[model samples]
Target: MIVERLIIADNQPLTAYAVEALSRSVAQEIHIEDLEIAYAQNKTQLNNLLRDGKKTAVVVDYTMFDFTNQENFTIVCDLYQNTSCWLLLSEELTPNFLRYVVYQTQNVGVAYKDASLDSMREALHYVMTGVRYISQQATQILLQKAAEAENRRDELTHTEREILKAIALGKTTKEIAADRFSSVHTINSHRKNIFRKLGVNCVHDAIKYALRAGLVDESEFFI
Candidate 1:
């Protein structure tokens, strides 16, 4: 495969090394297109160049122009809309952030900036072949972060967790209110706050989240 690579990285040595590691056919056609730093000069033209270019693998840095920022991500959104196959060169990547990047494109791959030659080579090779390359570091970090988030989940207020458990157990608002020795209005207010904190819209969705987060166990319910 010709495997056209459009790099938006500032580190020429790293990018050049990556280009060299690609399939032999691709090794010869390393095009920087427009440098990522060019966005600092004129983002409009930079986005235009990216948007107008042919559909190919885009290798860009996570630190390139504050790419995670909403304003900068708008440009990234536009770029992926007009391109395909993104390989992100990152520094210290988080699971949530990596997940966001993966959602933005097809066949997404992330490689740490300080990755060894083998890691870079493997990531690029997998990306060029239309495969997802999530490095060992990224996966391990994601798992560790998930555990940390689970611990944070335990920090919810006692009342909030009681309301959440009741909701998960399929109690109606009035039923929950009666059980808590409170009025329906108070229960509803708590329910609203629960939804807000859980980042969910409906009871079913909240229940699903609660199950996933280990906040509630269905087996514990009494008949």
Candidate 2:
């Protein structure tokens, strides 16, 4: 689990210095060869470093990096199988983005930029060891989202839940009726009941609830 290279891909100078200092300390303690430390101010430099296909560990503040989107960052990470990343998040990143990144990548660890030195060191150790590490702040956001989704699922009846899933899949009332061998009126009534139970007033909200509740996969919902 020796990290041959450590890339600090953050634009903020002070933050990068602090992470570099902490990383160097951990590397020294672990005897990780005083790994080559590189600074990537932008994506091109980051890509070039990763293209070397070495056992590299990266600590990046994605919010400040030039990635066009979270998916763009994911794409870059996916490109280098020999590389692992530790996300240095800021408080401004949204809960959904946090969840998306945590779920989307296997070789990425997450910690806030303001995290304690110990937490940062632990995250570095985990990422370099090919393990996942999520900070307390990010874990709270994910747990809260999971609780809300569970509550939404618990509030709906079986029929209402099925109807909501159908709606999320873009099925019309008529189509749902046809699939269930029921009248369109019955499907429409179930849709209304779903809205009432979920405290939503419209189909779009019900569909959103279904997506969040895990009744429908995100890809299915989008399609």
Candidate 3:
């Protein structure tokens, strides 16, 4: 079993279910916790998590908002460079967005909110093994997109790459912290660098740049 150091951004029932499922089947050493973040918190709970040093992968609800913007996404890319992450989206994802994320955080994976435990389990396995995972329904649509071949030569540092992945998967700084082992302040520092290096202001722009730069390849993306 894989030992996943996990975090949850949403405190909903399904988040609990997903965590339980992962703990039961996929992760041998599962560390499940929650980050309660409001716009007014002194330091977002999620950021505190990211600041921690232990490198652990994260699974997050797609609806969480802290790392919703481009800056925050870049921050996550910087902080959790070695971590793998999963985004449980509210609905089906578009091909363009999917391709963008594939480039931004090369290790990001996607699964629908309604996906089975086994599916999530398999996805985690794939990501940890250095492969990308997209749901079957999203596969053909993602491949159908007009894609540019990836240029590994322009690859971001490993850390920047992971932050990009977290953003692509729709994680916030607060969410990112809870999902991985990093601090909020450190996460923010990485954010600044990610924007500077990628030369983009928001998640959307960064993703587009990553795609255009040949940072991601659609053919290798297995949805």
The model with the greatest TM-score is 2
Q: What tens digits encode model 2's per-residue C-alpha lDDT throughout 167-201?
A: 88988889999999999888878877776666555
Instruction: Tell me the deviation in Å of residue 133 in model 1.
Output: 1.7
| Model 2 steric clash pairs | none
lDDT minimum window of 10 residues, candidate 2: 82-91
Candidate 3 worst ten-residue window by lDDT: 34-43
Task: Give candidate 3 misplaced runs (Cα > 4 Å).
Answer: 1-4, 28-43, 83-89, 127-132, 147-223
Candidate 2: lDDT of 143?
A: 86
Give the per-residue lDDT digits (tens) of candidate 3, residues 1-223.
1223555555566665655565445444333234221221222665667566445445555445455654455456456666534444445555545555566665456777667767767766554344567777566555444332133315467777777666655579888776668898877787777776654456676665555554454443223
Q: Where does candidate 1 clash, by residue pair?
A: none
lDDT: which is higher, 1 or 2?
Answer: 2
Q: For candidate 1, lDDT tens digit of each residue in 99-175?
A: 55554544567788788877877776665644667888877776675566466465668898889888888789999
Q: Using lDDT, give the best candidate's number.
A: 2
Mind sharing the TM-score for model 3? 0.50
Candidate 2 wrong stretches, greater than 4 Å:
154-160, 165-174, 177-223
Candidate 1: where is the Cα deviation over 4 Å? 11-46, 66-82, 102-106, 152-157, 165-208, 214-223
lDDT of 2 at 56: 82
